[model samples]
Target chain A: MTTSPTERNGWSGDGALTDMAASVPKAARKTSRLAGPASTAEQWPEFEAVAQPQLQGAAVRRLAGRRSNNGVGSSNSSSSANIGNNPSKRRWPRVVLIVAAALVVVALLLVAFAACSISRGESSFEGLMANAVIETGANAVSYDEGKTVYYNGHTYVLNEDMVSVLVIGIDRKESAAEDKPVQADAVIVVALDKKTGQATAISIPRDSMVEIGRYADGGYAGVETAQLCLSYGYGDGYETSCEYTTTAVSRTLYNMPINYYFTMDQAGIGPMNDAIGGVTLTPLQTIPKTQIVEGQETTLLGTDAYNYLRWRDKTVLTSSLDRQDRQIQYVKAFAKKTLGAAKSDPGLALSLYNQVSSYSITNMGMDEFSYLASVVMGGNITGLDVISLPGEMVQGEKYAEFYLDKTAVYETILDVYYTQVD
Target chain B: MTSEQPPTTSNPDPKVPVVRKYRRTIAALTVLLVVLLLSASGGIGWLIWEHNQREKAAQELAETPIPTVEQPVASTPDTPEVALPDNPIDFASIQQTSPDVYAWIYIPGTPINYPVVQHPNDDFFYIDHNPERNYAFEGSIFTEMANSLDFSDPITVIYGHNMHDETMFSTLHYFEDADFFAENDEMIIYTPGHILTYRIISAYQYDNRHILNSYDFSNPEVLADYQEYVRNPDSLLVNTRDVPLTSTDKIVQLSTCMTVQNWNRYLVNGVLIDDHLTN
Candidate 1:
């Protein structure tokens, strides 16, 4: 069994044969360990088979008493085995790293998609809600009903186009005995021209004398003439007040048939003001007094504007005409602010429309409201034309009674409403 | 024993070879870290720049001023002034003139001297025609020769539109109640020959019909009815103690359209009390 000197020299001539023989045994043993626990002891036998040649050569060298080269070679061989085994053990971490990286990317993409959808939805919802509210609220009133009335022996149709719509603001008290709502402290008429998109605004003093619908006692016959038409409307129904007041006013001077009507209580005005941001109008004078009436003061910026329109009983103002002037100022200021805001801020308009929808009632439908707003936005009517019926034109009782200036009123109406536009 | 010993003559080698590998692994990790950091920094810088641009545009729009209507452009004068009487009553000289003849109205206490041109068409006089001239400024006043204060009879009703600019009869709106009217009760109207001071007596809104028919210049009963109606004791601005109107008291009515339709016309009626001829 001992190797000859010639055979030994042959083994030394090529080291690949020795290295392969060493690796084959270790590879077979590792594979057997991975396969199962059953042939564990047999693995050593297989390993020994592969290592026998190299071991035999080493033993031959050892017999010759050489140690350092064998030690280093064995160390190198073992290290190579360790490096090879490391990649298999590291496999799990590599798979974990790849999966984690893929998950992070997917999560980021999901967040981005969610954010974009939310932003788009918010803007779209805002616009849709605004349009809905405006349309719904504006449909409450009828803007197109035509009523015919006689004035100065001539009959005229009071259509939305030719008639004046008086918006009355009434200050109501919680405790005050609820007679019909209090007299209109403030009155403004928007005389619209359907054909031309032109409108005239008239502010009436509450103290103006005019024939009102007959109330219980304060009257001559069935006629009660006074400036406070709201008192009549409140005491009587809208139709009766319209007839008595319109008839009296028509007979007095150049009055025209009445058209649309809007009544806003004090509570309604506040929200409308807030919805439109605020009305901006020039004040006629620096009002020293804060409160126009007891418990009613123009402290806030919005309320202050309201006060100018509502102030009716103070001696500081020489006459009702002065109050009328203040009312006109408020109208112009409100118109400018409302129209301007609608043009610039769509979100703000939506918010305002929503707010106004809750409190305001208008006869105009969605189409008419949109049309009216568009006309104003188009800049057709920039300046407001204000006029009043002449005193000499009206006739009635001294205190609360009054009449109309028929000629002047008709002429004014014709000029404002009927004149053909080129 | 001799045979077994002969079969086990060769011995096996046990030393193992080890190789250390560091260059490739270190290089891969370093490259991945650098790529992640670079991507994060670039994304953050882009977002900050977009936010600043939107803020700058909003501030500039808030500072612009609104333009006014009725500003007078260069144009020839419309209404020719009639020659004054030989006595030549000099109310203050015309402060400014409008290109159109529409009318010239003067009030002593306020700054309302402007050309009164018809609004839209030449049918009704409105102050909107001349922008340089505002009839509602303080110290400007308006007077119409045709209107009187007492609503009793066929009266010439002078009208002035109330304006937000405080130019025309804007101040008049303050007089509807008692206190505001008391503070500014007396306003003098200056015609070419006579300076007339009017005492504000009554202020109220009348039915539109009443305003239309009350201007019958020929009927005395109509004027009487107008006067009686305004003299009500319960008036918010006027009390019974105010003297009854006499023939000497000519009326001046200042009027403006109310925002309200058909309900009423905002009316300010004043009686002419003192007259002075200024030459």
Candidate 2:
């Protein structure tokens, strides 16, 4: 209530009084726009000091008229008559209004509460829909907002766009033969980045000493370090075996989440090769020219495709490591040719999937299948990046064990972690 | 109420009685306003209570325990070789009260524990019918007539209302967060002999189309093309797996209405990765 010098002097000087009068009207106009009881009373004292000498009655009537016009009127005539004249009048109507307003505000708040509760009852999906439906019209919502495990004290949230797949080439002729026992000859951890359209395969040689998980019932039985490929033998040739194999590979890489697993027996290869139309591989090693010889880009179809992938001559293809490189070449070629054809025809990639699905047992359903197809069909068949898990070829009793180089394995995973593809 | 009457035979200006009559009218109007305000508050309170009841019912049903039967082969066996739980859901007991209850769908991370229904002839039968078979605004989760009741289709498109209250398939929107979609890729559908597991591949807002009626699944070209289409979905803001899809795959689509630009349908898709049959 501290008065400015100009407002204080207005009681005496004529010009000052005129200036005060002008400001008072502006104040009164402002008072009408604001709510609450104290505002109207605050404006009256200045008005009374200047005008009460002659214009008291007119001011009172004007006050009543404006109050009614603003819709904050009361039916009490006594309060209306006394409004501009009395600075401290005990009015019951004001009390009534305050109570009514408080009630209204409470009701409104409750109504809002009920609305939120109702929306909370809707599923998160419906909320998104309702938000879009309602907010889109207003154009107001800002949308901001995994097998994942913590390794070495750092948490790596499993990337939704990233997936690790265990591709097991069961040592059987053709793909559908899972009834009898078979060994997983070729074990490769294929990692794909759908975002950058890049694929990397880290081949796990059969002899790496790693913990292979076994499942007793639906539970993880235990982990045993043996020849990396023997984990496949722990399960009785059904869903159990696939589960165990997936775990073995996942654990080998510090428990990376394996999103899906696919077991392809020998039977699946020919159809798969044909499914992708045909795959052409550049020779990583020469088979010493026997017609379709060494250092040549081999376009493989049917049985030849399988042979090129599984070939290992001590004099030519040489070792299991050599065979793995051929497999990687086959995969990269298959992806490039299939994905390339998909750009023009669109159905070629899916057709390939359908053609080969019968021989393979995988954990990928339609949605997973769709996303895979979608990423591949993304055009631009650049080049495939393949790396074999670095290891030492140690001489074992019967066969040699490719002792995994721990440092190299970690570096490869980090490469996948930080590497970005265009 | 004030009883102000007019003058019978006034010898004066007649303004006095008129004033009294106006005061009476004002009094009557004030009384009417109070009643209206009270009634409106009461109505809103009732709506809140009703919504809570529906949620309570849904919770009760989900928590109702698969009611000990001859035990559908123990769920978690001591060893991997032991038989996994595979028994048909007791549809007979569920249908005794509501014939609509058929299969049940459960997702661990999201709020998606509910009974699913199938109408043999009508696609929209359960769009307005509750699990209790009552005509409620929040409908039950239902698949269209275009899909086989056995869920044998390569793509079984299921539908449910997008209620403002999270009653039906509305929770499917939980997949909007790519992490939720990735961490919880498994979708379990309990059927007669098999417990089918589907990995969620893509979750995004899609155009409103009668999927089963629109696409000819029998055509390898159509099937193949659709697989690719879902891969590069129109608006995949959240998530997608980099898995390769072939036409030989089996997919089940969970479809619901989305209110967005042009108000279309939002779809969460899953592919059948593995199936464990029961004894």
Candidate 3:
């Protein structure tokens, strides 16, 4: 082939043709290889059909030769093949364009797929509600069931979007005897409405009589109506105790759902109190038995907050109730200070939660804490109302029993949980 | 045996012939690139159109006026049941759209106003079908055959999609906020001749267990246990009231999907607190 080009062009030597082939700038060589012959239109088809495959083969060999040269700096005989590989370079950009376009299509598909998945999940939600008419042998009300309850000639619905949690203050610490059952010193049901920023705490005196399941050796014993504090004594003094107490409170409070329990021993009060600097308030009453003086303005530190909560005169039958009033006062002040600090420092709530965790056991997770914190902080809550359950402390044979007023319980449940439906 | 290259120093022929030879191949490659380029843009356009369709459906439903039930004449005072005020609603128009639609639900302070339907044959038919019975991404608010159309069951569970567009029950998440739950506590369900108002008791995340299938509401003990679970759910994200839920109390549980956890559903439970006779 090299000799034929020299003879046809009337060149004197074969070296001249090789030099000319090599000297054709790489871009020109791309076309020159295919340009040979075809001076006449009649020969063009014949030349193209036979030349396409050979040109492709030459391009492929040239690439291999170039790669080898880079790797081993080897001298190869395929130098002439390299001159015809300009077409490969011209096609590189097109290949990249196709790939980029395909990627764009794929990315759009992924986004659309994500959006459809959300709708798909929502549409796939299946519900379980049975229409089977089964007679439960109970008298049916004359009006629409479940939607409205007629109470005292008034119709009311459960207030929308209300949240309630049971805050239990234990009488004993973790170091106490494992076998011995402990009492819940303070039982409070705190309800919060994030929208209204309205929060109320219903304090259940430890001695309130309620039905609680009695557990013996982790087995369920028969339920007994006893002082509410005794419910804590029925369990292993941890989760079981809280569960028992929650059931008792729920039953006593007209079966109100009291989820979210946070049980803390008496020892947690100090660290909790000190976490927000300290709680300052005027003493509500004089307690001669302890350092808490009546009608005196005081800022309580760690142990001071502990004394304000723990000291109850054993002589008086109503001493626990009196202590409860002061405990409510202290809690209100402490919470006010803590939440106020939390408004400025978002981490304050978590830090306070962590500080009390050593002496506390709770079903609340970090999400719950953050949820409540955000609610309390973002809500327009003026202050938390500390309410004492209206009850009469009666002298029993050996211990004092606080019997909650049924009407009061009903009224409280209505005021806190129900909205008038007119 | 054909090729001869001209000397680089004195090249006589022009390059135009070479370019002319490959013109058809270049044209084919150009066509392919254009097709690929068009497909990429077309894919994006299809997605936008799909999203617009979903939004259009939602917007149409939102624009539909909630029909009001006309109040009947004075009833017996001894009955302790009062008649509601006349709110004229062309319920006939609503029924015309779908005979399956039996009730209307309205929650103030949230975008939950919509007609409630029950597919007689398939419990899940309305899940992906609109009130017009057309296929829609945002399904209609529906109930299964497990519940009566009159809302008389001890527990009536209503199902809706938690659409990302916040058109369906997605706004139910408002109740997750304490302030929203407290301020907006009542929801109204209007049947043919009666207006029912339910008191929102609690808004909490619950397991995806079918309430009707999981418990026999016909059994008083089972109903009591289920009611207890409703009042005192084990979920961490919860907002509850001090309201009591008894086995005799007829409650409506609005169920939707949770955003974070697919296996769990967010429930806004309401107990029947008010019922008014309407024409």
Give the interface RMSD values of the models in order: 43.9, 27.7, 32.7
lDDT of each: 0.41, 0.57, 0.65
The TM-score obtained by model 1 is: 0.33
Q: What is the lDDT of residue B23 in candidate 2?
A: 48
Docking class of 3: incorrect
Candidate 1 vs 2: which has more lDDT: 2
Candidate 3 per-residue lDDT, tens place, A1-422, comes to 11111211111111111211111111111111122222331221121113333543455356445333422221121122234565543453455455445444544454444455433322110101101111221321111112234467787775545666789998674326554568888999988764576788999999988656655554554455688888888777877677667767765654444546788888888888888888899987765556668788888887778888878778899999988998899888877887777766766776787788789877666555555666776674546888788989999999998988877887787778777776
Cα misplacement distance, residue B106 of candidate 3 (Å) = 36
- Candidate 2 residue runs with Cα over 4 Å from true position: A1-422, B1-20, B61-88, B120-122, B161-167, B232-234, B244-248, B257-262
Off by over 4 Å in 3: A1-147, A173-180, A288-290, B1-279
Candidate 2's DockQ is: 0.02
Best by TM-score: 3
Instruction: Return the candidate ranking by TM-score, descending.
Output: 3, 2, 1
User: Model 1, stretches more than 4 Å misplaced?
Assistant: A1-163, A174-181, A215-221, A230-255, A288-300, A316-319, A345-367, A390-407, A420-422, B1-279
The total number of steric clashes, by the backbone 3 Å criterion, in model 2 comes to: 26
Q: For candidate 3, what's the TM-score of chain A, rounded to 2 decimals?
A: 0.65
TM-score of each: 0.33, 0.40, 0.44
The candidate 2 chain B region of ten consecutive residues with least summed lDDT is: B1-10
Report how far off residue A162 is in candidate 2 (Å). 32
- Give Cα distance to truth, residue A340, candidate 1, Å: 2.3
* Fnat of each prediction, in sequence: 0.03, 0.04, 0.00
Q: Write the per-residue lDDT of candidate 1 for residues B1-279, one digit (tens) a residue.
A: 011111111122222221222223323433543454355344444434433432332232223222112322344467354332221222133224432223333443344343333232322222222322433112112223233322233343544444323345444444443444555566554444445566767766443222333234355665566666655422212322264875435666666533322123456666777765433
